[model samples]
Target: MTRRIRPRPRPKPHPHPLQLYSLRDICTIRILRFASSPELLEQYTNASGGLRTGMLMEHLDSLAGSIAYKYMLGPEVETLGRVQERGFYIVTASVERLDMLAPLYPVRDIRLSGQVICTGKSSMEVAVKMEALNPNRREETLMLGRFSMVCRNASTHKAHPVNLLIINTREEKVLFKMGESARNRRKYAALHSLSRVPPSSTEAAELHSTYLKYGQDDESLALGDRVWMGDTLLEKTMLMFPQERNIHQKVFGVYTYQLGFANSCLFTRSHVSFLSLDGIAFRQPVPIGSILRLRSQIIHTSPPGQLPAAVHVRVQASVVDVQTGQEEPTNDFRFTWTRDDGQTVPRIVVPRTYQEAMLWLEGQRALKMGTQIRGSRLQGRDR
Candidate 1:
C-alpha cells in the first residue's frame, strides 16, 4: 500500500469590512501606548515603591470602557455624530476575578488589552489582561480581570438593550462560554451571599461564639485581642467635575474607583499589596458638581501566623446634594489587601452593629471566594 500524505489546514481569511458588523463585530481590543514613569508612579503610589493597585484599577476601567463602547456602538461611531445619534452610555456594573499575577515595576511599560467575550440583554463581559513590557525581554503578565458593563439609555438613565455578540471561531465560542459561566457564578453568589440573607446554622453558631467571647464582659474586650470596627475606617469627599465626566455627562466610574481604593488603602495602615477586588457595583451615576463621599472600613483581618496578613476593606461611595444635603448611595467597592511585610499581626475585627456585622460577613464571603479561585488556578498551573 502507498503511504498517504495529508495536507495541513489553511488559515482562515480575515473578514471583510461589511461582514465585521455582526455579533463578532463587538469583539475588540485596545492598547495603551504609554510607559510607566517615575512622575506617573508618584501620583498613584503611597510611601511605597511602585504603582498602587488603585492606579492599575483606574487604567483597567478606562480600557474596559473603551472596549465596551466599541463593542456597543461599532467601529464607525468614532465620530461625535454617530455617538450622539445612536450611541448609548455604558457604566461599569461590577468587576470580578481580578487576579494580580505579578507585580508591576516602574521600569516597564504596561500594556492593557481586552475584548467583549459575551453579552446579555444590556450587559457585556469584557475580559482584560495587563502585561508589563520590557525593552529586551518578553512581556510579563501582571493581572487579568473581567468587567461587567451595562448599557444605559442616554435620556432615561435605565438599562437598554445591546447588540448581541457573534462568536465566529471555536476559540471565540469557548471564551463566550467561559464568560457565561462567570456571569452565572456571580448571580449565584449574589443570591446565596451571607450578607444578603440570614446566616446558616454554622455561621450563626460562629457569631454566637464571637459574641460570647467579646460582648459578655468589658474585661474580655479589654484584653486587646480584637480591633474595633470603627478603628480601621477612613473617609474623604471630593467634588465631581466635568473633567471627570464620560460621554453621558456623569462622573467616570473609574474616577470613583480610584477614590474608593485610595481611601481603602489608607485604612489598612500598613504597607499593603493588592490581592483582589470584588463585586464593585455601581448603583447610580454621580452627577457633575455633586459631592462624592467615600467611606472605607476594614471589616476583616487575618489572625497572626497567617504569613501575609489579609485585610478586607469595603468602601461605600455616596453622593451628597449641595443644597439639601441629601445623600444617596452611588457605588460599593470591596478590596482585599495583604501586608507587604511578613510581620505577624493579631488583628481581629469586632463588629458592634447589625450593619457592621453584615459587612463583616460579606467580607468573609469575598475572602473565601477569592482564596478558592486563587487556589484552583494555582493547582491548574501545577498540573
Candidate 2:
C-alpha cells in the first residue's frame, strides 16, 4: 500500500474591507434556478411578468447580505450595526436578466455572484455578475455591474485607511481585473471634467448658505471626505399591463435612492459602509414596463471637521417608455456620507445662495430622516 499526502485546506483569510472567495468556494457554487413561482407572481410581481423595482432592489439587498456572509465573513458574518455614523456607500446597482418572451413564459434564469474587486486606501470596489444558468439550453449573456463604497470612522466621520482585499482564486482575479478596468475608465472620464459643472448664480448662493446651516447643526453625520458625480445605465424589462388601475405606477422613491446609492458609491471609489436616507417621497407614478434611466451627480462635499468628512450627491431617475420614446421624471434623491474619522469637516465648497442653500438644507434634513427610516427598514427587512 502506498501512502499519499493530501494538501491541507487553506486557512480562512483575515478580515478586510475588500475580500474575495477562494477557487474552491467558486467551484462549489450550485446554480440556483428561480423563476417567478406562481405564489411569487400572485403575491408581488405584476401580471405583465415584471416585478416592482422596489421588490427587485429588496432582492438585491438580500443578495448583498448573502455575498457579505459567504465571502466577507466566511461562516459567521461579523456584527456591525446599522450604517449609523460610519459605513460604506452603495455606488451602483442593476438587475441582470434574460430577455422576456410574452411576459408569462420568461425563458432564461439568472444567478448573481458578487465580490469586492478592489480596495482603495479608504474605499472598496465590488463587482456583481448575473449569469444565465441554463444547463441544457442556450441563453444570451444577461448583465454585469459593479459598485464602490467608502468606509468612514464611526465617530468622527472622517476618511481612514481600510484593510486591503486578499484575492486567491482565478475567478476572483478575473473580477478584480474587470473592476480595475472600470475604475480606470472612471478616472479617465473624470479627467475631462476637472472644471466643475458651474452652478447657476442662484444655485451657487444656495450652496454657501446651505453649508452655514449644516455648520450650525449640532447633529450632523458625515460619511466621507469627498463628493462624487456620475451616471449609471440600468437595463430593466418593463411589462405592460392594460388591466392595472393606473397607467403610471411610479417606482419606489426609497428603492431608486438605494440603487443610486450603490452606483454612486461605486463611482466615488467608496463602499456602502455607512449611509443615512431621508425625506423619501414618491412625487409621481411611472407606467409599468418602462426602463428607468438614473443619473446622479456629486453636487458638494463637506470636509472631515465641519461635521464628518463626507460627500453630498444628488440623484435623479427618469422613466423612459422604450416603445414610445417618451420619458417622465420618476424620482429624485440626495445622499450624504460620514467619514470614519471623528473629525467632520467640509471637503467641498458649499454652495452660496438662498434657494440653492435652502434646497441643500432640505436635502440634509431629508437625508437625516431618510437615513433613520431607511436604516430601520433595512434592519427589519434583514431580520
User: TM-score of every model?
Assistant: 0.83, 0.40
lDDT of each: 0.72, 0.45
Candidate 2 Cα lDDT to native: 0.45
Name the regions of candidate 2 deviating beyond 4 angstroms: 1-36, 51-54, 65-75, 78-109, 138-140, 168-171, 194-383
Q: Pick the candidate with the highest lDDT.
A: 1
Q: Residue 145's C-alpha lDDT in candidate 1?
A: 88
- Worst lDDT 10-window in candidate 2: 95-104
| TM-score, prediction 1 | 0.83
Clashes of 2: 82
lDDT of 2 by residue, 189-285 (tens): 3463224344456645655554555434344425333221221232233443443322113233344545555554544454422333321223455
Highest-TM-score candidate: 1
Worst 10 residues of 1 by lDDT: 13-22
How do the residues 110-169 of candidate 1 rate in per-residue lDDT, one tens digit apiece?
778788888888898899888888888787777788999888776677777776666778
